[model samples]
Target chain A: MIRFDRASKRYPNGREALSGATFEIREGEMVFLTGRSGAGKSTVLKLIALLERPTRGLVMVNGCNTAALASRRIPAFRRQLGVVFQDHRLLTERSIFDNVALPLHAAHAPLKDIDKRVRAALDQVGLLDRAQALPLELSVGEQQRVGIARAVVVKPKLLIADEPTGNLDPALSMEVMGLFRRFNEVGVTVVIATHDIDLVKASGLREIIVADGKVQDPATEKLVVPSMEAER
Target chain B: MSGWLLRHVQSALFAAGRLARAPVSTAFTVLVIAIALTLPTALALGIHSVRSSTGEFANAVDVSVYFKRDVPIEKARQLAASLRQRSGIARVEFIAADEALKQFREQSGFGAALDVLEGNPLPHALDVRPKTDAADPAHMESLRRYIAAWPEVELVQIDSDWVKRLNAILDLLRRLVLGASALLGVGVLAVVGNTIRLEIYSRRAEIEVTKLVGGSNAFVRRPFLYTGLLYGVAGALLAALLAWTALQLLDAPVARLAQSYGSSFRLLAPGWRELGILLGVGALLGVLGAWLAAARHLARIEPRS
Candidate 1:
């Protein structure tokens, strides 16, 4: 569903965040993006989201080279995928229902359909009862669920979640991962970038490790495994 | 969304709702604008009324017919009556040679000295006033020439000089009104522009969010434009009302002043054309201010870093 071919992003003041990184993500498959801090994990997701343009090489999502998509068309490209961030990025001023309904609004969905889908998505995340509550009134985990509900409300074909479990306790992290797994089971392709090795291992999903502005095949990395507290 | 667009028109009717939201502030701003716009408009209207009334007073006096010295009082009186019956003549008064002399004695401070004279020195005359249209220069000249050729008439002196000068004064007053409105119009634009600039600064966060959500520049500008248009309509309406009231307030005083000067003049407000100019200037000031602010600032913010 997505491909990054020798993509490199260089900031103006000589910050090379990504360099000659080559990778491919197939359709309807869930992949774990494992990397240390500053391994260019967020850059990869942003590239797919078309929030930032790559300095060189082609990045394709859903059969179109996003590097060539006009700025105005970026919203349409983003609508094709659901995005869950570590920060949730939910608008605190609005109710949970409104936050989740944003993606549909961006797509200019019919009111009836937007309402129906928003309820259904919130129900799937078990936040239907709190739909009218503002994000600031909700717990951090619930806020993350609101973000998840927003991402999936449009039923996008691809889901790119950056550090989805970064700010959560292990229990809540597992629960959120379970939600992503459920979405994946319904033929939605999922890519999660995380620093939590234990959580990634617990999911038993294929891991693609990134380090020092480069992506590597996990099978080829022979470095000692970084130990993690499984229970923590 | 089309559905949101329809339903949210109720939501976007923010001009009224926003005013309702902040009544005191809204009223304060509106009053400031109205006062700013009203003073000059009222002055223009007063000057216009004075010019029109003074012009009419000059035009109303009409022609003076100096009869032949040998003509009798009865002949002059008959001539006055006939002129009063003329198609365009409004009023005519006959002055007998003796009556003229007697009035001259009273006004010239020679009442006692005039009795010392053996014969009346003043000639018999007829004062004729024409209708408004007949007071035109060409028409007055025609009437003067026609009356001057009469055998019983010794001289015919038509006074249209005051009419010419009144017209010149009126033209100047009109130019001054236009100049004042123009200067104040620039002031209005600056006021709206500054207000919009403050609005843009205050709503910067909301704007960034809108852009991040894929809103176009036009979408970002819609609310501010609406706000400016609101200020314009509101300010113009208040200015018009204030001008009308000022005219009403001055009508009695102005009429009394004219009466003291032996005139029947009254204060007059602007006609339809001036009203159009007033509203047009308001709307124009609003749009220009909004456009200038939008062009200056909104274009600088990128959607995302």
Candidate 2:
């Protein structure tokens, strides 16, 4: 479960990234946050990940207040949630297997467990055979899948992705969203931040619309309506 | 517990693999460190040789106590006998006035001139050889001062001025070696720190990804620390080898020179103790350098959330 209770974040340079935004999502729920560039969607996810602290209100992840988490405990706190980036931030020098095994390595999991989970995660992303290949050798979509596999390799309770399909074509984006759907089906809470209104509606999931550093009412936001494509 | 151990071993192995991937650069770095360390080691060996030579001449550093002209040979003999019982004095040989004059005539080639004198001109004296440990110039000087204070003794001459001068030279060389070693130590640290900084810079993206995925700062730093450690150890071993080879090349000539001087002293190669100390210093510097670089740079690289 994730909750942001009127949380606000202000950059040091007098830019308000988030302004008293409040939201709550139930356990095992998949949610999409829609906002234009610099609308503070990423800031919300960052607060949840304990990467940044809220300037005013409390931010909670899995029933724990992230503001109270010490810097020394951030790594352990981060291990509980998987995060995907828009850039597909895979270590180019390492093989796909090594990249995916990174989380387990960070946790100091047993080597055998790392091998088994890495293979399983790679298989989930349909890239098990490409585990030995470097990220640079893969297509952009494939590299993004590897990133996804890496994020989920630790079986984190919640997964947050920031414009994960921003670099993909429409079909590839759909495929990436489908992968998230599958993860959500298996009781993994998923939250995605994207500006793609059509893609958010097509999934027929709960939508939280952010605009101008504040969350818009879900009923009044036209982009939150289910799409005709979803009805089909 | 076993998993943690395995992770550390894996990180160390990974560092070695990275070094192995770039053999030429790594070799060059190691060579630089070895050369830096070799100068100090060779200088220390030279100082050690000088110290050993000084030790060999310790027994010859005796004090000559001369009695006043009015002091009788019987009184001087009694003084010598009493000096022989002292702790630091190893032996006391009394020379009667007539015997002293005879020796002076034989050595000084003034036989007819000395025979011209009505009475023996040379005073009775005691040649005092100090115990081996007390034969250093400083201790010898102290013994000379103690003897000069005697009521019957007119003067005490210590035959250790040249030895004192040699010791001063050795001391200066030791200080120079220490200074050189400290400077080279800083050089080694800088070399390692720069290398690690570059490595960290090149791998900045990888480090960011590692941190994003829950890797602790210690985990991210482990490999670089190991890299620094390996660099230090390899350099130390190479320096030891190089110093040993140089000593071998010089040993024959040094032995011959000593032989020509009718001395049996030989060059001393560094033993295990010296090697251990060198290796320890190298490793410590390596770790310190890496830690400094990592601490300075790693914090600035938080993942962009």
Q: Give model 1 RMSD, 1 decimal.
A: 5.1
Fraction of true A-B contacts recovered by candidate 2: 0.83
Model 1 residue B14 lDDT?
Answer: 52
TM-score of 2: 0.84
The sequence of per-residue lDDT tens digits that candidate 2 reaches over residues B64-170 is 88899999877888888888888987889888988878778887878888777899877898888898888876787778888888889898988777777888888
lDDT by residue (tens digit), candidate 1, B1-305: 56867534633485466556777876776777778789788988777777766764665756889988888888778777877777877778788898888778776888898888888767899888888878877788888887888889998887767777877877887888788777887878888888888778866765654554445566667667777777877888899999998888888998898888668888787778878877777777777888889878887765442
Error of 2 at B41 (Å): 1.4
lDDT of the structure predicted as candidate 2 = 0.88
Best by TM-score: 2
Leading candidate by lDDT: 2
Q: Write the per-residue lDDT of candidate 2 for residues A51-155, one digit (tens) a residue.
A: 789989988899888888889899898898999999989988899999999999988888889989999999999999999999999999999999999999999
Error of 2 at B177 (Å): 2.4
| Pairs with backbone N, CA or C atoms under 3 Å apart (clashes), candidate 1 | none
Chain B TM-score against the true chain B, candidate 2: 0.76
